[model samples]
Target: MSAAALVVVKCGGNPAVDADAICADVADLVRAGRSVLLVHGGSGAIADLADRLGVPHRTLVAPDGVTSRYTDPATMEVVTLALAGGVKPRLVAGLSRLGVPAVGLTGLDGGMLRARRKSAVRAVVNGRTTLVRDNLSGRLGRVRTALPQTLLCRGFVPVVSPPAIDEHDQPVNVDADRVAAALAAALGASQLVLLTGASGVLADPADEGSLLRTYEVPATGAPGRFAGGGMALKLVAAREALTGGVGSVRIADGRVSEPVRRALNGAGTVVRLSDMIPSLKGA
Candidate 1:
């Protein structure tokens, strides 16, 4: 199927995420008459700059042996600066230069993304499981659907960053994938393209053949395929979007030409969630 009314994209902050390339790709999508919401991460730069400044970068070990980033107060500040001060504006500027009439805003603006505090996180580091304390992470709550709809209706591309505070007035850092998922569901997006560094979700970690061209996952699973770390969380978020009435979710390599445009035409790891699990069980 062609991309829907709203195409929500998550661009990773990895060096390979290629902001310029991403901007051009989105411009192409817009030129093709598609309404787009651009969401991005800045953690890669945040980590680099934090290390250069001698700030402590923290990771934790989950009981299941997965490593994950733990957002403390300092990290939350860094994330805020990175998202607001850097990522959001830069993309907006580029899109504007490309004649997209883009506008940058934190999820807090007009209550675009109201989130709940995530008090606990699990991870694995240095061969030890640990509970991540002092998590300032956020979960999405109310999505100001009207703001995006208004922006789209007025021909402006809305670029969103790390969410703002909760209604209770707490600023929590949220994951980019979760943001993408929530945006997809809120907009009733036909396709959610997650541009990551990897080729796609692999069936086996070691073999290239493990690449899953299409993921028609069961509502429940055996666990190892997407367990132990961020992948587990991503899979969970994907499920949330799919089960909650979004049409589809795809995780694809972002370094190529027109990644977003390509993803819409079945150019990556397409997770066909609009269908049921039993139909593909024997295939």
Candidate 2:
């Protein structure tokens, strides 16, 4: 498969998502001669492990209303253990069972993902803006595509996840959606599909029928005004992929059969850079 045929699929960490179905779909795509790179999130698994280990799992709500995991030292440890030890192995095994050679990798592996740690962040806590200084989360800085490209060339599906290595050469939690976007851009993939629990980017979160076929993220403001919770971050990731030169970005439901194929065929919300306001394109 050529670079234009490469597809980056991100599997959501929500427990409702069917990982088995996704792996099966990936097998079909590979058999049909499409190159695929899988990136997965493990928030549910991390929370579960944190519970069992007696660690407090918390979330930080940005002023714009986007909520993200508050990855302090303890939570960061949980994130690493859950994704690397549990979630990744399960995905690799599922693919192997379906006859797809899958290699599980973390962002720290071979510096596949490098990030700059955000030593502090401003978040809204109980209606008060607080400066969070100890959160061990990082913003993605670079994606090294050689490792994944080599695997894809050898007919192996590379399954990747987060805990990106920061400038200090330490692991820090990073959002998986952003990871998918960065990889898609670096690989020059034709499509970046983010499969989540929701049907798509719904105009109303309570109604699945209200799925927006296309959402134009504003060039200069927080997309959270249009979407709350995880959807907000998905929109942000979509914008990044589009601006970074990925052909297209889609937010689709991961619970159904053939989720990836459906998204590629336009079953979900599509985001394109052309949709942004022309005057604010570079803002």
Candidate 3:
């Protein structure tokens, strides 16, 4: 029997996510015998849709006061339209073109991604502290392992995204990384790779030398903790995936060709625990 390997890949919905290339890359990986689960984000599309709809997407300030986009119900609607209707099918067709069978699913499907609606969020009300309930975002807590496990066992790849279901059965917004982490944990995936527009985790986004190839995920307190904007959330998600038994989590530039193969073959920054980091001098 061939040893099956589970790999969770998050195709950041940055403008760089080319549906055709991503599908081709995934098909190639499957042909090479790796079971891949694709989880994607559609922030760029959501932003564009928000502009067209005149719905102001709001980024929330955490209780710690860190700022980030918090999806309300309206925003979640945008997520579904982009992720399920657009991105998901594009990827499915892309893989289909390469003769790789793919199944696209969302959090609401068979309880794929589950979480609680954290609508009682904290916010600043005219300079005064206020609680913002009815928030559409939720903390990703669990994923239905059976869904992907069954598909993977049958040699089919599952492509997925956020807006996971909570214990209450509400469809809640979630970070792609968070969903990836949960999926990786459930699938016993050794590698979880995040493909984004910018070069993989850079110490200095402005300098080339600052590119970190193999670095430890620094200890953090919460799910979205790190040094800067999205990187912090990514770091937090990486930590979750690592601690959940995934052997390694990688961040790479998605715009590059054959991104998945490149990431597996050592073409990106590797975020791992100190002991897990390999000496990548020659790689």
On residues 1-283, what C-alpha lDDT tens digit does candidate 2 reach at each position?
4988899999999999999999999999999999999999988999899999999988888998777899988888899999999999999999999999999999999999999999798899888999999999999998998899999999999999998999999999999999999999989998899999998888778988877787777655677344789988888888888888898899999999889888988888887554343222111
TM-scores of all candidate predictions against the true structure: 0.86, 0.95, 0.88
RMSD of 1: 3.5
Between candidates 2 and 3, the lDDT winner: 2
**By the TM-score metric, which is better: model 1 or model 2?**
2
- Residue pairs with clashing backbones, model 1: 61-123, 61-124, 61-125, 61-130, 62-123, 62-124, 66-124, 203-210
For candidate 2, the per-residue lDDT at 12 reads 99
Worst 10 residues of 3 by lDDT: 274-283
How far out, in Å, is residue 174 in model 1? Answer: 0.9
> Which RMSD values do the candidates have, in order?
3.5, 3.1, 3.6
TM-score (C-alpha) between model 1 and the true structure: 0.86
Off by over 4 Å in 3: 1-4, 61-67, 122-131, 222-226, 274-283
Task: Please report, in order, the local distance difference test score of every candidate based on alpha carbons.
Answer: 0.73, 0.89, 0.76
Candidate 1, 194-270: lDDT as tens digits: 88766666665555455667766457552234333555555556777787678878877788877877777776576
In candidate 2 the C-alpha lDDT for residue 7 amounts to 95
Clash count, candidate 2: 0
Model 2, position 242: C-alpha lDDT score: 86
Candidate 1 runs further than 4 Å off: 1-3, 61-68, 124-130, 205-209, 218-229, 273-283
Clash count, one per candidate? 8, 0, 3
